[model samples]
Target: MAKLIMVVEDNDLNRKLFCDVLKAQGFEVKPIADGNEVLSAAREISPDLIIMDIQLPGISGVDLIEAAKKETSLKDIPVLAVTAFAAKGDEEKIREAGAAGYLSKPVSIIPFMNAVKELLPG
Candidate 1:
């Protein structure tokens, strides 16, 4: 079966772009536009990987990552943080928050695919 991916992004354009890219890569993509719905949506979707955006409306992506890590069922799933704030120390912050990988926006197709590939088992 194709791997399922959850994209938690507040921006419509970014969310759509991520969904389109993942879909093209043959992934079953679930896009969540609201930060408040992330946990419940994740529970329902049970995605293999989560591509999260940092600057969310309600809960920050970093917080969500930490929360996911604490959950028994969701903890095993890798979370790749995709953020526009590629400023100094942002990558480390995401990593400390328990993200498996980090990708800076605007994400190039190749790099984005590569990141996803790394997270998935062969």
Candidate 2:
């Protein structure tokens, strides 16, 4: 079965780009445009991986990742943080929040896929 990936991105172009790329790679992609909708959508979908955007409409992706990590049902799911913040300390903070992998935007196709593959379960 194809792995299900949930992409939480507020930007229309980015969301479409992610979904298109994941789909082409044979993964099932669920694009969530609003941060507020992520948790409930994740619970319902039970996606294998989550591609989270750091700056979001409602809540920060770091906070969302931290929150998801606390939920028993969602804790095990791998989170791949995609952010525009490439500052020296930012990656560490995102990692501390519980992202299994991190990629900066605008992400290159190969590296993005590599990060996704590395985070997905076998």
Candidate 3:
């Protein structure tokens, strides 16, 4: 079966771009536009990987990923922290939040896909 990926991003264009890229590369993509909605969907879907945007409405992606890591069911799913706010020390903070990797925006397609491939290798 094709691997499933869950994307948590608020921006319309970013979400579409991520989905389009992953789908075109044959990965099944589930796009979540709200940080608040991610947990419930993640519990139901149990996606292989989660690409999360740090700045979000209601909850920060770092906090969400940290929460997910605390959960028994959700902890194993690797979260790749994707953010436009790649400020100093943010990468360390993101990693401390339990992200398996990091991708800065605007994401270069090749590196982004390469990271995904390495994370969820078939």
Over the full model, what C-alpha lDDT does candidate 1 score relative to the true structure?
0.91
Best by TM-score: 2
What are the TM-scores, per candidate, against the unseen true structure?
Answer: 0.95, 0.98, 0.97
Runs of candidate 3 exceeding 4 Å displacement: none
Please tell me which model should have the higher lDDT, number 1 or number 3: 3
Model 2: residues with Cα > 4 Å off, grouped in runs: none
| Candidate 2: tens digits of C-alpha lDDT, residues 14-80 | 9999999999999999999999999999999999999999999768999999999999999999999
Tens-digit lDDT track of model 1 for 1-122? 99999998988988898899999989999988988888888888889999999988767899999998999888888999999989999999899989999999989999999999999766
Model 3 gets an lDDT of 0.93
What lDDT does candidate 3 reach at residue 11?
A: 98
In model 1, pairs of residues that clash are: none
If both were scored by TM-score, which would come out higher, candidate 1 or candidate 3? 3
- Cα lDDT listed for each candidate: 0.91, 0.96, 0.93
Backbone clash count for every predicted candidate, in the order shown: 0, 0, 0
Q: Write the per-residue lDDT of candidate 3 for residues 31-85, one digit (tens) a residue.
A: 9997889999999999999999999987899999999999999998999999999
